[model samples]
Target: MMYAAGLAGVAVTMLLILIRVLLGPTVYDRILGINLFGTKTVLVIALLAFLGGRTDYLDLALTYALINFIGTVAVLKFMQYGDLGWAGDVEDDSDV
Candidate 1:
């Protein structure tokens, strides 16, 4: 029962994020929507693990959350620099 409720919540969040993503005024707004969706997914995963009686799944959820954070950071950096290889004011030894 609890698990069902969690799934419902996740569905609701996804719908809301989709709406925001569609109506977003800027790229940043859409990126925010995507970030929110990722967070909601992590919660849903944790809830599913609890429902399935698998504590180990919670660890997996955490791992995914970390990955999501790293991915988001990378995306934001790329967006700001217009390239993933940006190294602001820093020169690599190989460049010398």
Candidate 2:
């Protein structure tokens, strides 16, 4: 019962985040919402796996986590630099 409740809560939160992704005023807000939604999806998958007593779901969840991380980083990088090339040397102003 607890797992079910937790899953439900995560689902609701993901749905709310989806709404934010749709209604967000800025690209950054949408990107943040997508990142949050991906995190919640990982939680939901893990909860469902526990509730179902299936260990295989964990593998899927792990794969999803990796993909989500890569996707978020790629999107954020593209948003920041308009490209994915790592050849450009970024000067850190913090060092100044």
Candidate 3:
């Protein structure tokens, strides 16, 4: 029915995002693709839960979204600072 068609569309979108992730020209582009893929995954899980009449799956989807957000932030931070634990203090290069 309509739900099945919606699922198919989402699947196609996810496939496209995967291609972007694989063929992205830059690291940031790949990272953006990954973030988008995660978002689509969340949507897919939510739709599946609705299709199955399972409320618990909605909770699972929310948890996955939280993890995705945290993971994306950690990765971007690591990419920018070269360390996940970097403090926000600017290094004094004048002593060199």
Candidate 4:
């Protein structure tokens, strides 16, 4: 009963986040919305696992959370550097 209410609340919040991701005024705003959505997804998975008495789902949720974190970091890095494999500034000495 209470779990169902919590799930409903999370679903509403996720819907709002999805809207922000789609209509965000800036790229950063969209990125933040995506991150928040991922967090809510993890919460939903956790709640479902608890409600179903399936602890194995918690492991899947953890894995998804990790992937979500890594993906967000990768996207942010690409946005900042324009490339995922960007290396820091390197001094050129071969001309000497």
Candidate 5:
């Protein structure tokens, strides 16, 4: 019962963070909310696995963490400059 309550609380917190992400005043704030949501998700997954005696599920959490980090970096770079180029190394592929 306690474990369920904890996971439910984490889910509620995640929902609040989602709202913040939607109504953020700035790109950075939204990114921060997104990062927080990802972190909470990882923690909840780990907690559930531990409660269930399923340690192997941790590998899934690790994969999600790596993907989340990559996505956050990409989003930060795009928000800073509105482009996905190689950090100010834009290339023109037209020969006129």
Candidate 6:
């Protein structure tokens, strides 16, 4: 019973995040919402695994987490530089 309630709460939170993603005024806001949604998805998968007594879901959740992090970083990098490759023309001061 408690597990069900917790899952329901997480579901509700995801729904709220979805709404924010749709209605967010800025690109950054939407991106942040997406990142949050991904985190919640991992939690949901973990919770489901625990409730079902299956350990395989944990593997899936970990894979998803890695993918989510890479995807988020890629999106943010693309948003900032308009491409995935680092701009060679830009000088790095840290190397100096």
Model 2 segments more than 4 A misplaced:
93-96
Q: Estimate each model's TM-score.
A: 0.80, 0.88, 0.87, 0.86, 0.75, 0.86
Off-target runs (Cα >4 Å) in candidate 5 are: 87-96
Tens-place lDDT digits, model 3, residues 1-96: 666778899999999999989998898989999999988888899889888889689998898889999878998899878998887567766655
Candidates 2 and 4 compared: the better one by lDDT is 2
**Between which residue pairs do clashes occur in model 1?**
none
State in Å the error of residue 91, model 4. 11
Over 4 Å off, model 3: 90-96
| Candidate 1's TM-score | 0.80
Candidate scoring better on lDDT of 1 and 2: 2
**Prediction 4 global C-alpha lDDT:** 0.89
Candidate 1 local distance difference test against the native: 0.86
Cα-based lDDT for every prediction: 0.86, 0.90, 0.88, 0.89, 0.86, 0.88
lDDT of 1 by residue, 1-96 (tens): 978897898989899998998999898998899888888888888988988889789987898788888778888988878888877655545663
Top TM-score hit:
2
Model number with the top lDDT: 2
lDDT of 2 by residue, 1-96 (tens): 999999999999999999999999899999999999988989999999999999699988898888988888888889878999864566665654
Could you tell me the lDDT of residue 66 within candidate 2?
89
For model 6, the local distance difference test gives 0.88
- Cα lDDT for residue 87, candidate 6: 62
* Residue 65 displacement in candidate 2 (angstroms): 1.7
